[model samples]
Structures are given as structure tokens and as C-alpha cells.
Target: MVYVNNVGQAIMQVDRWTTLAPGQARNSVRIESYAVFNKGLFILDVEAAPWGCGVWPAWWTVGPNWPWGGEIDILEGVHDNVHNAMTFHTQPGCSLPTPNPKTSLGPNSTGWIESTDCNAFANSNSGCQTVDTSQASYGTQFNVLKGGVFAMMWADDGIRIWFFHRAAIPEDLQENAPQPNNWGTPVAFLHNTLCPTSKIFYDHQMIFDITFCGDWAGTSYISSGCPGTCSQRVMTPSNFANASWTINSLQVYRSPQISGASLALPRPRSLMYLSAGLILLLLYI
Candidate 1:
């Protein structure tokens, strides 16, 4: 179910208080943006993200036509993960550099390249993933810090993702003028000579989902050391007490060279709740 909290944060959550029958999927929320973006800056200020076993949550963007239009996973995790994985899902011929240069990581970034291939068909749809090594980057620890900001830049050069702790968010970002270049090295950088951004990614819409015991989460359920099987856990409603998203705001800014929308105006209301969590307050700038 979805609603605004007493603090005015947009909340999308699972049916944690309801018990379900076998083979039944938990009721949740999945909302997408009405407006599509070609290349722009996306900022998500999160107060809390879903956690716990059998839970898979993501704040991402994807184009039409599946793999061809490409997918960028800015914030995604499954189960009891302590770190975040930034990924790109696309067709073959898209890849990041192996033995990535040290400069790829900003001085403050605590992440590393996990895979170079962007092929969704390869390695079981692993895609090209850069993983944040910091324990606070995801899950339980992230909630302890009360969440923070995730800024992504999708541009001609490539895509870059940066995470800042609540206490360390950049002043310019908080002031409404985000200068990504000055923000230093991103935790994950998807640029490479082999992958042309223009060919791989196109008009895409933002997506936020909180799924239970799906492919990504179920496949790794046992390995995560969570008690019982994924399906069994799904029947236990209380297991998802923490499986919800409390969002402060979501804002998008087009490049100065490409102008269309004004700065910080609410987009048209077109919320699609299929199966997971969504951001209720989204602004276009």
C-alpha cells in the first residue's frame, strides 16, 4: 500500500501485516514516471529503504524494448546485503574496461568494478556491475544512518552514480544546483570506449520496486543465511516489517544544453502500481 507519512514523506510498503497462502506473492507497490528522460541528472533523496531477507528493492531507470533500450540500476539490493550494486543492463558489445583505472573511483568512493560485460544475456543477466564496498552503502546499516542522497548523471560521456551519507551531502546539491563534475569521483562509473551511451540508452523512465523472493532475491536466499526458504518467508508477514521505502523527494534536471522543463516543477500524475515501491513526489527541472 502507498501513503504519505505524518512527516510528509512518501511511503510505499509491503503487506507486512497480512499472511498469505502458498505460491502467493506479497502485495507491494511499483511506480514509474510519466515523463521519459533521454539524458539528464537524477537525484533521489531517500529517508529509508527496504531491507530483510526475501526482499528485493531497486530505484532504477529503463527504456522501452528491454535490453535494447538499456537499464540503469542506481540503487538496488537483495536480501541481507550490506553493500550496494550499481549496474547497467544492455545488449552485447557494451562493456566497461577491465582492470579499470584508479582514477575511475573518486577519492571518497568506496566501490569497485564487479563485472565489465553489459550483456543481460550473459552471466545470467548480471550486467555490468560496480559494487560499493562500504558496509553503510545498503541494507541495515543504511537505515542506521537514516539514508542519504543518490545522484546519477546520464550524459554523452557515460553514466556516473554517487552516494553521500546524510551528514555529508554536498551543499550545491542541497541548494538545488547540482554540479556533478565537482562532486568528485563517483562510486560507479559506466563510461568506456566500447560502450557508446547514445546507442545503448534512450528515453527511459524511473522505476522503484519492492519485490519479494523473485529471481535475484530467491536465487541467493540460502546463501544469504536467512532462516527457512524464500517462499516460506514470504508467508511470514512479519519478515517484511522493514520492507518499505520512505522517500523524501525525487528530482530530475536536464542538461543546460538541452532545455525543456522548468526547474523543480511537479510532473504530470501518472503513477503505475504493478508490484512494488514508488516515489510519490517526483519533480522535473
Candidate 2:
């Protein structure tokens, strides 16, 4: 279910009123950028995000070949999480240093470090993670603030993520001159000192997806305090009324020195929208 609103915003939504069979998966949307990028500043202005039980929503970037090429999870969380989790998935050897100089634990950021090892095979593929402490960073609280901008700066040195509430957006960003240095304390930072981003991350495409009862969500469904099982929730049609993404815009600004593909706004015809009306059910298996 993908449609454009009267104001030109894209509304990628999940099926909210369809009762499914015992083994059926609910329909949802997962869209990706038309072009792959090497390095740039990407900003996503979101009006609403999918929330509630049995849903996992994320806005992230991924290189080729699973974890070998690296994956950067800029905005991600499952179920009724209040804070967004920023994570990095890479091959073994790339790790976030303890007492990281660029995380919330560091003097330069505001997100608390969750895991330091970025290896996709370690800790149930948890990756290196940092969690935003702000109550308005994810889920229902975020929508109450009418959403905001999630800015990601990917450079040769490192990657940094910042979330600005609708009322506190930086003036420079509004003026189209994004000076990340002037923005104080990012919510998440992955430096290159220990994690060789150049080798681990490359040719990444941006992604937005809403999946239900998958690995992350299904595995922790009971613990999330949702009623009944995750599969049972899928059969209940009313569990997904708010499971949608109302995106105002996604803007990408590339540096002349970055030596990557030219960044262009997604034209309506060029955008690839995928809405699986009959997706395979994925449980804790």
C-alpha cells in the first residue's frame, strides 16, 4: 500500500483491516533509494512512523553482500520502543573502541553505547549499537511531535546521526547549507579509528521498511509485553491502524570531493515502490 498524499508526501502503509490465515503474513511496504551512494549527507523528514506491537520499522543504508559490505542502521527499533537505535553491521575485525571517542559515552555525542563489536556474526547479529536517550526519538512519542529530521553524515572519517525535533531543527539545515560541525552532539557516532569504514562501507542504498513478526520482533514479542503471540497479532486486523510512514521528503547532498555518484531527488517515475501483498510469514525461526 503506497500512495502519495495531497501534499505530495509518500504514505507507505501496512494492511490494517485484513484478517489473515494461520500462516499468512500481513502486507507492508519497503522502499529503497533509486541510486546507490558512496558518501554524502542524507536527511529524511518524516511526519509519522509505523509503531505499535508486532511491527519493526527502520530507515537505514546497506552495502552489497550482507554484512561483508557493511550496513548502517540510522533509525531502527522494534515494537513499542521509545528510543531509536543506531547500529552498524560489518565483517569481523571492525569494532567500536571501548570508551569510544565519538559516542554518547564520549564527550561528543548524546547516545549511550549498547554494543561495541560490529561483527554481524557476534551477539546474535546485534552489531555495534547506540541508543538515543530522547523520549521523542521513536515510536508514538515521535509522532506526537509530528516527527522531525534524521540527518546522517557519512564521511571517510566516520558516520554520525542526529535527530532534530520538528521545533528544534537547525537553521543551517533549513538554509540548505548543512554544517554538521556546527550541530552539537550527535545521537550516534561511528568513528573510523577502529572501524575502517572505507573498507567496510561502500556503495550503499537507503532503505525504509515495515515488517511484522520477523527475527527481531518475533523473538522478543513476549518480552515486549504485547498481548497474545506475535502470530495472533497478525491475525487481528486492527493492530496496524497506525502502522504507516508519512514521509515529507528525503534529501541527499553530496560533496564535490566525495567522488561518488551524483545525488538527485527521486522523481516520481523513477522511485521504486515495493508493497508485498502476500509476504511470507517469518516467526522466531
Candidate 3:
């Protein structure tokens, strides 16, 4: 889960997400998979943004079983979510196409597409979502304009997400060499001909979490009005003190057409289940 707090000399991989203070039944902090990807380009420069009223933060990508090694939530929403959806759970022969679901956008997309069957439970689970027209991009107005830039461009031939706000991020990803074709429009897009993005995606890993009531803030807490459940406002501790998640930097840029890993290929994690948050890049071109 990549959390080397007080290591001595050189390990350096800290996410420092905190929680478990306020009340007590809900706890927080979750960093799954240090780094693991089968594609390329995954960036996150969140400085701070996880609003209150029973928060349920997330950053996703999955593999290791469950839905046949596929699941990408990107950045979820909960509580008083003002925007930011981007989902994709899978298993049943992959799917897409809803409210203009196509790929390779770069003209500064606003983002739409509610759900178009990314399987997981077929329609009811409502995977395959995409909605982020920048209502500050999500929560507390995206931490008041201080946090932005989340780009994920996995490639077999499709999967793109771009959101740059902290002064319009793009300049080769602030000089880190992340081109992403000029970083224009792509609030979300999924292609690879609908399925077979390497047999429904694989080897994902990379997740940041802040759990609370559970299953999406106790099943949506009556759409954030707060009636009951969600374990009673997570055991009520001043309603989570504005939640947490304040990451400042993260970068994974690989894909000069594949490098040292030689072509990250491997399957059969016995039937994986811990799944996606996508961060294990070595995808050479």
C-alpha cells in the first residue's frame, strides 16, 4: 500500500492520508498496491479535496480478479458531491456507449455519459459512468481551486481522462514529459473497440481511499441530506471534520513504447479480487 512513514535513508513513497480521529467506527486511510500498471500515463496532482458531510473519497484502478481484472473508478464521489464520476467496472465482455461515449478527445471536454454497462452487475451497479463538467470538478469546489490535474491515459487503444484546473495544467505535464497530445478535451472516453483492451484490462493496482459508512457512504445517505445509516453519520464525530485526502504529487510516465519491464505480461493472480486504482506503468508505447 506504499506507506513508508519513518524509514531511515531511502524508500520515499508516502501518501500520508489520515483519519480515525473524530468518532471511531469509520476509520480511514487506504493505499492499495504500491505501483502496478499494464498501460501508461497516470498522473495525479491533488493538493487537497475531500469535502465533509460524510465524505467517501477514492482514487481507483483494479485488477487481481473480480470482474475479470478490470475496474477503474478514477475519482469517485459521495456525500455532497458536486461532480466527478468516471466509473468502469467489468466482467461481462466489456461495454461502452452512452451519451456520446467515444475516445481520444482533446479539445477540452466537459464530460458526460452517465452509465453504459461496464458490467459488474449490469445496469444496476451503474458502472461505466462519466460526468465531470467541472463544477469545480468535485467537492468543496475542488478544494477551492488549489487542487487539480488528474490524467489517466491507459492504452491498448483507449481510455482517457483529463482534468486540469490549477491554472490549466499542460505544458508537457509541467515538464515531466507527459504529452497526452496537448492535453485538451477528455473528461472521459473509453474505446479499444468497446472491449478487449487487453482482454478487459489487466494488472491494475493503485488506489487511495478514505472509507466511512461503507458501500458509497452508506448507500448514498438519502442523497446527502442525512437521514440515518452510514453507520449513523459514521458514529458521529463532528461529521468527520472535513474529511482528508490531501495528496500533492504523483507521476508515472512510461511508454516510449515499452521499456525495462520488457512488456509487463502476466495473469492468473489466482482469481484476483483486490483490483484497480491503476498505477504500475511500464507500457512502452
Candidate 4:
């Protein structure tokens, strides 16, 4: 839906009012951006999110192929859970290093990593992931607080994600100037130097989807012990009243001018220097 809210900003949502009966199946909503991006920054402000049994809503990015390409799940969860998780999916040869004792985290650095292997083909496709420690970061609690802003800074240095409460949105963002360096420690930080992003990851298209009774949500729906089959809970209407999303917009920012030289320049002491040295050595011999 499209309408102007009291705040006078345009809004779009996937607020389904009804539900399917037992054995009924409905294709969930999925919005994928056509543009492909590699290195950039993104900030998405959501007014509400889908949070209920058997509902798997996520805002993420994925490449064309499966494990060979890559995927970055910025937000994902199953059932009526409140905690939020971030995951990185790739092929083999990509793994994360455990944080050392010397590493210090700020107040916002409360994320707990579940797995260190980013390879989707490995670990049963669990991927390298981390969960947010903030209660007001997702699901029921997040809506109760009137939703919030999620910022992702993707660079060769590392991939970092930050959460800012609706009320805590920085003035800089409001003014359209986002300075991530000034922001506090991210809720999720995956160091990519070891994985070498270019090697395991590739161009991706943005995606926002809410699927029901599939892999993550369906297979694990019973883990919450909801007292029924995954499809049973999913088909019930009352179970999905809260399964929706009220989104403002997604903003992707990148450098206006390309950095570095467009063409490669020869080194000061390149192959020519080596050739000259080899000739001199042969003369001495």
C-alpha cells in the first residue's frame, strides 16, 4: 500500500489482513531490487515488521547463483521471536576468525555469533552469523517502540550493521548526511579481511521477502514448541495479524566519483628493472 502517514512521509507495507486455512498455501511477498551492487552503504527505516509463527521475513541481498555467489542476510527471524540475526553466505574457503580477548566491544557491540563458517555449502547452509542483543531491535519489541533504522556499511575493510531506535535516530541521518564513522560500534561486525570479500562474494541484488513454512521458518517452526504443525500455525488467520511490514524506504549510497586510477600505471622498479639486473648478473658470471 502507498499513502502518506501522519509524519507526512510516503509508506509501503505488506500487511495482509487474512490467512490461509490448514493445507492452504499462498506465495509470500518478495521485493527484489533490479540493480546489482558490490561495495556501498545502505540504510533502511522500517515502520513495522512481520513477527509471528511460521513467518520468515527478511531484508537481504543475494547474487545470481546459489552458494558460489554470496548472500548477506541483514535481518531474519522465525516465529514470534524478537532477537534479530545477520548472516553471510558464500562457498567454501571463507571462514571467520574468533574475536580475541584484546578486542573490546562498546555498548552497542552486543551481538553473539552463531557460526564462523560463511560457506553456504558447509555447515548445512548455516553460514556465518551473529544475533543482536537488543530487545527493541526486531519483531514485537521493535514494533512496540515504533520501529527503527538499520544501517549497513559494506566496504573492503569490513561489513558492519548498526541499529538506531526510532527515537534515537541521529540528526545527521535526518539531515541526509550519514557519517557511519561517527556512529557507535555496530551490533553486527563481520571482518572480511580473512575471507577476502572479492574472492567469496560478488555483485548482488537487494531483496525483501516474507516466506512461510520453508527451510528456516518451516523446518524450525516447531522449535518454539507452538503446539501444532508448521503449516497448521501458518494457515491460521489470527496467527498472521502481526505478520506484516510497514517500510519507509531503502537508501543506498556510494562514492560519486570513482576512486583509484582507471588505468593501471607501470611500477617505478618493474619488470624492466629485473631484466636489467639479470643482464648485469650474466655479465659478471
Candidate 5:
């Protein structure tokens, strides 16, 4: 079920995330209960507004240790008309080789630059690829003008992602409903491995949030002409102006047939009745 936290503003925000100052790292947000991620699948579905130049907004995941555990950046970028980068931050030992198909914009369009020189994974390195916005700019692409769905799925083997034009998101998964079969396996992996710590992999609470300007989207690209104050180039006053990213909701689901139990269960009361009858028979005998 989807739970909306109505505390801060009528606007949507998950209680699981702590809002930080503009310069805070994405890893800095503390989570109180991530235990729910044990063995099931987690999905994040967001509908966002477009922000202007230098304003970076993202929906990502990170683990305890820096690169040892891993990090998954599902959706991240600055300008509305630019790109939506999907990246993996892993330990030196683990090689995150981009498949032969490498980068793809839509199913037909493909091409992306891979960088191992700069540490995009570390606070020092920032790596990304731009998605063409000629068809529909980020602002118009997501808002009421013409929005779309950006999804990430997490599972055991690997990670995969797919972007759907507003018209494409299947009707069932549209409003944050947990529709596993329709999501497919590859997509599920990308969403799950965002921050793959063996213990916390599938058992942590996933979060969806928006910050004005933080380290990666805000500062890392400042030298490349991120517009803002010279001292803190990532922070742009115009960022909060016409900028906003909206999430209709987020939903999670476990495999339908994981432990041999039927996916279709009638009701809790029915199960209770069967247990009560078994208890009475045992006592009588």
C-alpha cells in the first residue's frame, strides 16, 4: 500500500528521508528503518517537474560503505532539456561493465560515453550521459504538459531500467500498484541493486525525495559552468523557482510464488478460523 506523509507541506515527501542543506551528499540522508527490504522486490516510480540549469534532482540509493556495498543512481540530471543518467557505483574489485548494447535513449536510439578516469563514484568523480530532449523537454515531458514515468527495479542478479513515455506505463502499474509480472526481470534488477549490501539489499525502506542543490548534481559540475554563486556554484536561486519533481506514489511487492503459498489469499479472518479449529481438535484429542 502507498503511504503519503502529509507533514511538511501538502506536497508529497516520504518520512523515510531527511532533508539536508544544499551541499549535503546523497549518502548523508539517514534512514531509521530499512528492515522491510529483506527478500522482496522494491520499485520506485516518479513523476517530476523540470528545473532549470545547475539544479540537479535525483532518485537514487546508497549503502553503508562508500563503494564497497554499491550505489545505484536511477534518475539524475540538471537542466530539463538535457539528460537522465543511470549509473552504478561499485567497489574496485567488482567490474560494472556496461552491456554491449551500452546506452539507449528509446529502444531505437543508442549511444553513451563511459568514463573510468574520473571517479564519478567518489565525491571527486562525476559521470553522466545526456538524454535527448528535442522530442519533449524535461519540463514539458513530465508536468501536465506531457509527463512520463521513470522506473527502477531491484532483484538478485543485476540491474535494468526503462523509461516510458506518459502514454506507455501499463494501466495496472500506473498509480503505484505492485505489479511484478508486468515489470520483467532486468528492470527489477536495476531497481534492487541501487545499494546492494548483502544484509540490507532487499530489506531496506526505499525513499523518494527532492533537494535544491547537493554535491553531485550541484557542485561536481560547477567548473563545467554550473550557474550559481561563485563560492557555492551548485546552488542556483532559479532552481526552486519553476522547478519541482512530483511522484504520484511508490509501491513494493514480493514474488507471487516464493514459498509455495498461493498468491491468492482470501482473508485474515478465514486463516484465523482454520487455526482456531485445529487448536480445538488437538485439545479434544
Candidate 6:
């Protein structure tokens, strides 16, 4: 996938990859690649994201079963809101706490709930949760009009993530790793029984890209309240025209490391001599 701004261009491309059509929405796209499932890695870098009510910009991954398979939401939020959330969609056993203390779910609080129990907010949407930012700690203190980085890593054990502000991106991440901080804070979402086998659990590849507006952010009545959808509440035509979710670039590398050993045949004489020596030793014995 590729995005071009008036200044230049940003591209998201992968070998042996698949792209899905926009789903029931105007500004969204989906890309899939089972090849990277248990082999390599996938990285996404979003440029400037659109902020408005009914606007959903996401970078996430899912497994076979819906709630059972597990969902990892790297970056997801309504436009112009301060708190962008990192969530995991899983079975009953893997629910996360509201206002995650470890990651500082924050001061102003909208609590957490189980996937099966979030029905009150489900006005027809499948997986819906209400998070109030002014009440939450993170967004309450800052201005979210500007875009940032969001990222996730699906590995052998569990998912790991990091969210960085544009200025806070580590030098190492900027030079070597894809910069997720530019979009938002990175968080890992996990699911129970998503991977029945240990071999396949952490083996699947991850994808990174941006969706304009869809299920989560584009929900009906999203622009009503104080901590309502960011896109609906915050975006202006001027900013929407000038600002956009821009992806700089993406790169994938084997964690630990990829073996570099080469396979070559031994010289015939070397093999023959070794074999003859073994035969002579056997005879002597």
C-alpha cells in the first residue's frame, strides 16, 4: 500500500501479501498474509492520522476464531481524543483490567470490561467498549490533535509493544526499528486459547497499516458525549485536508537472529580418506 502527500510519498508493501477491500466504510483497507503467520514479521508505520468522529485508524491482528482466536489492537481511537487505547480481544480467561496500572491506564477513568460483558455499549457493533479520556489519565493531560506512533510485536511467547510520542521515539527505533511512537503508545492485546499449540501461538506474523473510519470509530452516536469519538469531535476540514496518517516505512527482522550457516559438500578425497580410515580401524579392532 502507498500514500502520497503534497510534499512526498509513503509506502507500505510486502512480499507474498494480500489486501482486502474497504469494509462498509469510506476510508479503510485490510491486508492479510498467512505466509508470515509463523515465519517472519510484519511492520507498519502510519503517517498523520485523520481525527474526527466516526473515524477509526487502526493497526492490529487477529487469529482464527473471533473472540476465541485473539485480537491485538496496536493503535485505535476516535479522532482528536487524547487517550488512544491498546487492547487485547480474547476469550473469558484473558480479560485486561480497566485503567491498566502497569501502563498507567491513567487518572480520569473509564474502567475495563470482559468481551462477553460489554453488551451495554454494543449498539449493534460486535466488539465495543467505552473508554472516557477526560476521566482517564493519559489523554486528560495532553493535546491529541497531533498524530503519534503505535506498534506491536507478535513473537514466540506473547505480544510486546511500545507507544512513543513523536519527539520521544528512541534513536534505535528510528534507525533500526519501525517508529510506532510517531502514531501513539504501543500496547499488546492477548487472547486465551487463541493458539492451541505452543508451536503456533507466537509464530504468526503481525501487520501494520491505517484504516480511515470503520466499525469502532464510525459507530452511530459516536459524537455525542465529552469523551466521545475524536474524529467526530476534533477534526476540521482544514486539518483533515492538511493532516493525514503518514507511514514513513516498514522493515522486518528475525528476533534472536536468523542463522547464516551455509551448506556445502565435503571434497570427495576428504570423505574417501575418512571412510577408509574408519574401515581400517574397524578391521584392526
lDDT scores of the candidates, listed in order: 0.80, 0.79, 0.65, 0.69, 0.41, 0.39
Summarize candidate 4's per-residue lDDT along 1-285 as a digit string, tens digits. 334466544333344555776687764567666567775677777778888777888989888897766888898888877888888998887766664345423223557766778888777899988788777677898999988889777776567788888999987766656667567678876666567776566788777777787888888877786668887776566677777767665567765221212211222111111121222222121
Error of 1 at 67 (Å): 0.3
Ranking of all predicted structures according to lDDT, beginning with the best and ending with the worst: 1, 2, 4, 3, 5, 6
Regions of model 4 farther than 4 Å from truth? 1-21, 99-109, 256-285
User: Tens-digit lDDT track for model 3 on 95-124?
Assistant: 665463364222334577766678887766
Instruction: Give a tens-digit lDDT track for model 2, residues 1-285.
Output: 776667777788898878999979888888776577777788777889898899999999999788878999988888899999999999998877565555437445688888889999999999988889898799999999999989887877778889999999988766655667677778877878888888889989778899998889999999999999999998877999888988876667765443212222222213222222211111001
Candidates 1 and 3, the one with greater TM-score? 1
Q: Per-residue lDDT for 160-179 in model 5, tens only? A: 45456567766655544434
Model 3 worst lDDT window (10 residues): 7-16
For all predicted structures, in order, the TM-scores are 0.88, 0.87, 0.30, 0.81, 0.57, 0.52
Over all chains combined, what TM-score does candidate 6 have?
0.52
TM-score of 1: 0.88
Per-candidate clashes come to 4, 0, 26, 0, 22, 37
Per-residue error for 227 in candidate 2, Å, reads 0.6
lDDT of 6 at 52: 41
**Over 4 Å off in model 1, which ranges?**
100-110, 256-285
**Cα displacement (Å) at residue 55, model 3:** 1.9
Best by lDDT: 1
Each prediction's RMSD to truth? 5.4, 6.3, 17.4, 14.4, 10.9, 15.7
Write candidate 6's Cα lDDT for 1-285 as tens digits. Answer: 333444443433221132223332233334443433432233444445434443445556666645545555555565455565555554444333344545344222232322322122233424423232332212322224233344444544344455555565566456543332243322333322333222323333344444444455555434534344444333333323322344554444444331111111121112111121222222121
Model 2 local distance difference test score:
0.79
* Winner on TM-score (2 vs 5): 2
